[model samples]
Target: MHPAPSVIFFTVFSGIGFGLLVFLGLDTFYVTGWTAFVFFAIAYLCAVGGLIASTFHLGHPERAMKAFTQWRSSWLSREGVCAVVALVLMGIYGAGVVFLQVHWAILGHLGALFSLLTVFTTSMIYTQLTTIPRWNSWLTPLMFMSFSLAGGALLSGNVGSATVLILVAALIQIVLWLRGDGALARSGTTLATATGLGHIGDVRAFEPPHTGTNYLLKEFAYVVGRKHSTKLRIISIVLFAVIPVALLVFAPFSHLLAALAVVSHVAGAFATRWLFFAEAEHVVGLYYGKR
Candidate 1:
């Protein structure tokens, strides 16, 4: 819940990258030659760059390779496997489309499926954490997928579809916030429950866990003030949804305007992702009496 910049970038950019791959794999645009090359380049850059960024968040980046072996049990491991499979499939498909000008329909469709699966696995990594009630919801996956698809639409130059999907993503974001606001309380977790002392009596911390901050406090117990959160929510919605939709629907269509919309959307994504981690109420916070 520390809102590490690397993780945020990984989720946002990789989601967008995979989303773009979905559209490309489906042959949404008849891109060929240099145009296809540019599209694939952007997609690969975002996807691969994000994966690389994620390594920096690891305590031992070199050990990241071990994550792939836990695919049967760990969502994180599943994500790694899916990402590799999706990238390889998409790479082959992209090469054919960009250089050979051949649309390998089967390969493209499979790549798209794996790409989507990769995003799902990424979301599950968060959603599976019951310790964080705010993220332990089905809506988390929906939110991720919606944003990815919406961003993909924007990048693919489908202005009409992008407007609608972006609007939907905004609505989902609003709903997620609303639901997450009470998720902690609704989870029935408290100092009593956390310490298994509810049967004894009312439980309260008599003293601090320590005189100074520690790793748990720095990581899982990070907090954001309510007023600041509200302001950021507004900013995120405006940049992610309002401006993009307004420009796409009302402003005269132009490549520059579309690019601006993409930029605004990605910025908004960063804000939303920051809030996602910062606002999470980890059950460990109850141990510190900080939630």
Candidate 2:
């Protein structure tokens, strides 16, 4: 699948933002007054910024709101609705907390639940795509959930939870990558099956679809070389998991290290998200005989 920059930013940034909002709502870490203000500011910036970024992925950005009406079937639409609901609940709870220093415990909890659900719906958008074998896994949602919790913990200075969740996220990432690398082969999708030519011995693309790249080639048939992808997987692990965990282990003694850990984790997670999109092999590629 095409890893559009806007969609990548939306998923990575909003996942972290919503993750932070989730922890804030659950009162997972101590925050109040100016501290609460800063946390909420960061959360809203990431979440809302991500939502706005997604609009750029649309051909008609002005009509993006029409997506909200498809909540009954489309996971993308469900994600939009969930994001709005999460933001609204958090906004109401945040107004009091940031202004009057009121926790509004119930509202906070509800917002937190919705925020997590938003992430779930976002993951479903990808997982529901049977066409993309790499994304069609329970591990995708778990990975997203873990990244959210881990990133949220890092942002809120919850070292212990961050440490554990980072480990979980890293493990899931490793396993998913290993599993995803083989998914295309195991998917039972071939040019023959895809073109309804199984009765024959083989099927292949004898001629180019066009003299130049077209929309299908540019979008659904994007490919990353195996070696380059492997290198990126290592870089992503180091950035998203290893380095952050190491820095966080020392964060209790140094404020700067704590902040650096969060930065490293965020950067790492962004790389991870990029790889996620780049590595996906949309079954549509079978039609191009690239599978």
Instruction: Give RMSD (Å) of candidate 2 vs. truth.
Output: 1.3
Best by lDDT: 1
Candidate 1 shows a clash count of: 0
Per-residue error (Å), model 1, residue 39: 0.2
Pairs in steric clash, model 1: none
Global lDDT of model 1: 0.93
Query: Please, what are the lDDT tens digits per residue for candidate 1 over residues 58-140?
Result: 99998888999999899999999999999999999999998999999999999999999999999999999999999999999
Candidate 2: list runs displaced more than 4 Å.
none
TM-score for each of the candidates = 0.98, 0.96
How high is the CA lDDT of each candidate model?
0.93, 0.87
Tens-digit lDDT track of model 2 for 99-205 = 88888999999999999999999999999888888999999999998898888888877788889999999999999999998988888877877889879777778
